[model samples]
Target chain A: MQLSDSLNQLIEALRCQPGIGPKSAQRIAFHLLERDRKGGTQLGSALTKAMTAIGHCQTCRTFCEQPQCDICLSTKRQDSGTLCVVESPTDVLAIEQTGQYLGLYFVLMGHLSPIDGIGPKEIGLDVLEQKLSQGGINEVILATNPSVEGETTAYYIAQLCHKNNVGASRIAHGIPVGGELDLVDGRTLMHAFSGRRVVTQE
Target chain B: MQLSDSLNQLIEALRCQPGIGPKSAQRIAFHLLERDRKGGTQLGSALTKAMTAIGHCQTCRTFCEQPQCDICLSTKRQDSGTLCVVESPTDVLAIEQTGQYLGLYFVLMGHLSPIDGIGPKEIGLDVLEQKLSQGGINEVILATNPSVEGETTAYYIAQLCHKNNVGASRIAHGIPVGGELDLVDGRTLMHAFSGRRVVTQE
Candidate 1:
């Protein structure tokens, strides 16, 4: 707080990051100005360019610089019948890293939270409904997390797909693949039990 | 890495921060663009301003916005006879925060490592020698950390002060104030015993 006005301002602005606090902000600001001013300038200009150029993809609501995201336009990822619906663009990246599931995506960006007045339309659910009604997608995989808001949003999307005559399924909620039995939480255990599967002999 | 081009560029540039890696950089970039683009813009502009405006103080080599740093220009801190020579500007801040020392400071910005080609001139030791020759300073306190390079730098500075007829002293190396005896290392314990203070009867 005893730094120059501009430096203090930069530190303050850096705290807008999700996990960054005053100490981290100050450290980052000082590091940028003291050790890497050229990179700092590049970061500043890049920040402006990214913010100014990026917007929601028209088809999936994922962040992109064009009308549609590359994922939506790719012929390589042509599994259009199976769409993975997620809560945010970061989820898209997480799924993309697996190099599996060559399908389209729908980024809600947020779940339906009635108390905060974030309803279906606020997160582009209308766009999703329109896509479903167009009769191309055969299965809608609800990849939203198992929290209350996420569950509610998934249920609403599922009901919408059912009304539109498209198959809808929620992503399974259970113990993680590499999880230990004793370490798993109660809710996860319950879901894992409820979602039990049987092995078939061919 | 599958993020949009500008977002990926921003993430890559964020790696220039001292301790940040790919994961934290991506999280920071996504957080900035997704939830706080306005703040991102402010931070970008603030970086440009701070980088453009800040310069080293002529006398102390500490960051400043003008010809000299605030500490160097302040008339209240007039104990120019007792000077603290430290390795970096952060060291000056640390000493100033204690509110115990009231003296001018000289920041070297780095230690003296001869093999790496960082000799006296690289760290502006000649400028310090010139200051010492001016005859206003009476005692020079070396507050460098207790390390091979730091001790060497301190010894070299102490010799310069001694040659100029000025008193030279080093900050003590001992067990930290709240350190537990069992947890402290052997070398620190040895220093604690060596620098033991005498008890005076009340």
Candidate 2:
């Protein structure tokens, strides 16, 4: 059927996401048309506002509206000489939901994937090393995902932390094989967090 | 986790759609950030644009950008005799996808569900009767869904059409039980279209 050019354009734009196929895109488009016209407007405004307002935290590289994220700004947090490293800002959110791990975060913003041409520098590993060298960090937890790429990235970071003589640990691999951190259940994620293992220097 | 107020607001607004949970909403929000920052803005803008630009088709009761929808405005469509009656505009799109029907459409926009307090006036049955009495149309294919509510609505409309001496027919029920037309495969929808039965005058 011939939808209006404007409606068609909107659906085409939404189809860029991973799971949203054409049919689902059309359903979403029609649904937006059916209800929440005002909501649709807000979504547009919010997207622009967020893109322009939110920036990566200088310390952790996680998304933040201010120069420092809430976790970084708060003195109430543990900050007990421990830091957890992760791939993306969303990962930080996943970890925070447990209400455990009060230590600081170091967001990599990406993982090491040689095949994809992503190197240590691409993921801000040098920045991480610089932060560790500054001292006061007794423990560094490798909380990257459990994928092959994540494992490789974790190992590289772990080796670097050991060279700097900082205590290094790797988050557990209890997560299912070939699973994304975002897809894991909350309780399972909690278990994985508590079962982290210390990395032996080689 | 402490999401910024704007990000949190965007997530809340997106969660209103069917099948979108909190995590999915966040994923979509993040993906929007990564790609099509502009398109995300457009989606919100379009939501408001469509909501404000469109209203129900005056003739069919289906959503339309103008007073008469594209389907109604098309001179190439077979508008001389037959009319296909449907429950919603989405249903109209479903039927149109088959490339089988060449007749005009009359959208009910709702069904006769007394428990939901929906009645004839609410669904625009009076307008349908008025169109039938105008005496140019010969057949009305009742393309309402096969659910209990859909069946009841079809029967009520069929009765009205028969009393007015207009030829009325109900679309087939070969559609699987508990299945919506939008979800059914196009081929099966084609089968249902071909297998339509004529409504007997009682």
Candidate 3:
């Protein structure tokens, strides 16, 4: 290739992003080089700063520049005494977008995949247990994904919550609100039937 | 979003890439933060170095860290006295990968789009004309894309080559080598018929 060494290095480095292959990496590199050098410079500084400064919040394990995240530090969220556990930081953002759940969050960062060597401690369950044993939180909501690993991780965390005398509950599993029953998968339809709520009483 | 400041900035900066949207940007940010901080750091440095260090080659207008590209400086290619004019650096890379072309390239960076205010000067045609006048090149191959703007740019460059007594020819346009004739578009099929070459004597 006639590409300069720095440009080639830039293309190679761009592939580090998820879902960016060789073609996409080359496109991005050229786009930045040709049209968006300022944007490229901005992204470079942003990546450098984030990679160096961002760290897991001590209280919840979600990414935060400080020891504790803004949500954990907020008096209202802390006093609410409800902690929602999730697999990643994005899930925390998804739940926060609803604005209905005004509780704090505990990001596991990953699920309990024993095959991949991810255990309870790896997901920060020990820190969660310590927080539960400290005795201020009243409820722990398991908002993990509905995959096998997520379910196993939730169940283990529930057991830990019970050990510390705190109530633990998994989020409901059912067909999506806007989805048709027939279009839903079999297991999801079953969950919808079993978890059905009574409407307007008798 | 509950994302920290640095993390949020990183996500925002990631959207500057060509095809990445908000969702992809968030996914990339979370992925780097959760699993590949090292890769993220490498990409950061690479971007910074490339954005600051890489500049256009004086001879070809393609990306290069120094004054001229390696291909432009190579004695064998310099003495070949044949120049290939292309729309972008990627096209040069594509042609080089074919292993048939040994001549050097002149990258226009983009085609002429009058609506976007791009003209001869913007695509660096003046430099190309000057190079043509310098008298080392014998043949100038116009390898721009088959789009209307690409055609216009190629025609303009061909005129410049003729003015300077250099032979200019456009690359062939037809259905791809392995493609079915039935699947080919009308204009391409028409071009194939008009540009057909003779076979061995019957």
Candidate 4:
């Protein structure tokens, strides 16, 4: 039997999510209608509000409802004079959860990919250059992922930082803390060995 | 760092979907904001419209925007005098996809589970009884799931149909087509043996 138009529309629309497929979309639609109408209504309003209202921060390009993000507006982070560059807003969240970094973030929103036509401007590198040239930031921490595209993007940003006479350092690439040495990939092992630090220089 | 209020709320509201966790919610939120704002907006409006407008069909108790679902209103299905009772709307979709079972459906929405406080009335059995007593249905197919609760519910509904002088039959349960006997679960194998049909009469 044909589903109602509204239900069918909702199911079709749900395919916009990253991993959901047709079956999953239908399941989710039925779940909301059968069990969680209140949650569905709340999600609808939330999606509407976020989609229309949320935009990139003027300074950092991370998602925000206002002109600037919270971290960018904070005086403490500003005083630190260190900028952490990353590929996405979720990376900002991951770093923030660590509570180790006290600096503003410049979210690239995506990595540089020449094949897909994504470049400096597409990932907002022009904005990053402007931020670097403005001269408040003493250092830039490239925290992009370890993927090839992420590396290319980080290297490009590092070049920009150097051109502006700012110190740029990449986040370490090594085996995870709890990961077994044998399980680590060749590249990671090589990087770990090459970048090893002397704990006790006796 | 604290996400913007709208962004955070969107993430939280997204967790209402089955199988979505906090991390997936955040990922989906960022994905929508970054890549598919138009799709997200469409989904939001569709969700809002569906959640508010769709209601249980008065005839079959299935989800629809009208008093009667399309299948129930169809003259062909109505004339069949066969009503298939199921546990959810998705089951109706599944049955319909097969191009078989061209009959009306009564969605129970759930099965009887007294431990969880779900009773016959909760699954819309009263409405089903009313439909049965109205004197047009010749047979009621118990297509509820084969679980214990489903069996109990089917038995209850079958008794109701008997009282209303309507025929009741349970859907067959056995090994799936193309399923190997060795791989089939013991219960299913037992069912296959017990419910064996005489294909040819010597």
Candidate 5:
């Protein structure tokens, strides 16, 4: 039997979520309508508000309601001299969750995908370059993934940092912790070996 | 770095989707805000509209924009004396997709989960009893599953049918199509064997 027009439309609309298929969309739609009406409104209001209120942080390019993100504005964090450059705001969150990196961040939002017409300008490289050129930043830690596009983007950003007289470093690539050697990919092992650190005598 | 207030709120609100955890919620929140703004708005508006407009079908208890669901109102479907009773709205959709059962449906929404304080009245068995007494349904197809709670609920409804002088039939329980016998559960196999039908000479 055909569902009501609104329900069908809602089900169709829910497919907008990443990884959501027809079955998942229908399930989510029904779950929202039948079980959590209040939560549905909260999600709706949040989406509506985020669409209008959320934008790029002026200094870091991360998503935030204000012009600058919380990381960029916080004086309690480590000195802004060391900046971590990443592919997306999610990457920033991942690093922050470690509780290790207390410095600031620069989110590129996307890599330099030339095939898709996504160039340096598309990811606001000019703005990042301008910030680097102003010259207080001492080092740039390129924390992009080990993919080809990530390497290229990191290299490009590194060149920009060099021209601005700022030190640049790429994050080490290696097999994940708790990963077995046999299960590790060959390329990752190669990277881990090449980037291995030397032990110092006591 | 802590996400902005709106972003955090959105991530929190997105956990309303069934099976979505903190990680999936964060991914979905970022996916909507960063990449699919228009689609996010569509989902949001759809969710909002559905929360207000969608309600229980007076006849079948399935969700619908109108007082009666489309299945309950359709003129093309068979107006036979048969009525199919399912455990949930998803079940109704599942059965409807088969395009086989031409009869009307009555959704119980849940089984008799006594531990959860769900009794016959909680799942609207009283209303179903009232409908049965009005006297148009000649046969009730108890399509509820063969699980403990489902069996109990079906038995209760079946008794209601007998009181109203209506025929009650349970959907056959057997190994699923394309299922191997070795993988089939013991109880299901036993039911399949006990309920086996005799072959007629063609």
Candidate 6:
């Protein structure tokens, strides 16, 4: 569209983000230019600051501005014999949103997909195994997504944890909440039926 | 969602851009952390560089890293008494995409919406008029969008240009090419039929 060089550059940069296609990037770049000049400056500063300041947390492999993320550093969090393992920080956020899991996390940073060249080493599985072998975690929850890659990754992790003498289990796979059987995809519906838990409530 | 503090901060910063809702911001933040760390770093640098380096071109109000935008500086562009006046730099880009116009630009920076407290002064219309009166630009094309605010701003500028003895005309509003008459909305169809131009052959 022949945008000014600077605006074009900004749009190109923003397009690096997943799901932010060219049109959205252009719209965002122009909108930033039109309004909130100070906010634009702040956005730029934040981007640079975040890139420079944040790094993988040494304990959990989650992005952290500090040496250890707040979640990893907090003593108030249940440091019991339970650890929840997930594929990424986004998964960590999703689990945290439930307000159910009280244990610490061990972010894998990625899933194991042989097709994409992501192996156990690529996803920091060796580190996870080391943590499990240290013998503090009694229950290891494999909370990776229900996708094939995620399942394979979870299974591998669970097998390794079992070999290291740590208890491990995968999160249940089923239809999402608010999903109707008719509306749910065939694969998900099948999974939901197969993994159905017995109702105990009267 | 209990995101890591750094990730949350990054999302908050990204929310400044228009059309970036909380979910999209969160997705972008997480994607930056998950994949393409190098691309993320480049994006960060580009954002900082563009924000710190670019500013409004003094002449045309378009974004520029230098005193004047490249378009304004280019001697090759025909400054042949034609000036395309637009609401913003994005509008300039839209017009440029047509590749039919061979003229300079006068970016209004915003529309004239009194209810919203945006006046002619706010949009730099005074500066535009001043430039017109300097005897270089004979024709000013009002290329604002076909909206109430855009119409109000265009009419206001046209009146100013007429009073100052400069030629001004509104850009055509019609259904897009390749769009079906039946599929087109009522307002657009009406405008298209009304504004239909006479066919000509050499």
Tell me, per candidate, how large a share of the native contacts it keeps.
Answer: 0.64, 0.45, 0.91, 0.93, 0.83, 0.62
Which docking class does model 2 fall in?
acceptable
Over 4 Å off, model 4: none
Instruction: Give the range where candidate 3 chain A is weakest over 10 consecutive residues by summed lDDT.
Output: A1-10
Q: Where is model 2 chain B poorest over a 10-residue stretch in terms of lDDT?
A: B42-51
| Candidate 4 residue pairs that clash | none
The number of the candidate with the highest DockQ is: 4
**Model 6 lDDT on a 0 to 1 scale:** 0.81
**CAPRI level of candidate 1:** medium
Q: What order do you get sorting by lDDT, best first?
A: 4, 3, 5, 1, 6, 2
Q: Which residue pairs in candidate 6 have backbone atoms (N, alpha carbon, C) closer than 3 angstroms, thus clashing?
A: none
Which lDDT tens digits does candidate 2 get at residues B30-72?
A: 8776545676766666655665676777887777667887777
- The regions of model 3 sitting more than 4 angstroms off are A199-202, B200-202
Q: Choose 1 or 4, whichever is better by DockQ.
A: 4
B10-75 in candidate 3: lDDT tens per residue?
Answer: 999999999999999999999998999999999999999999999988999888889988898899
Cα lDDT for residue A15, model 4? Answer: 93
lDDT of 6 by residue, A104-185 (tens): 8999887888888888988888888888888778898889888888888888988998799888987877777877768888
Relative to the true structure, candidate 5 has a C-alpha RMSD (angstroms) of 2.0
Clashing pairs in 2: A40-B44, A44-B44
TM-score of 4: 0.96
The lDDT of each candidate is: 0.85, 0.80, 0.92, 0.93, 0.87, 0.81
lDDT of candidate 6 over B73-96, digit per residue (tens): 767564577888898887787878
Candidate 1 TM-score to native: 0.94
For each candidate in turn, the TM-score is: 0.94, 0.80, 0.96, 0.96, 0.94, 0.89
Cα DockQ of the candidate 2 complex: 0.41
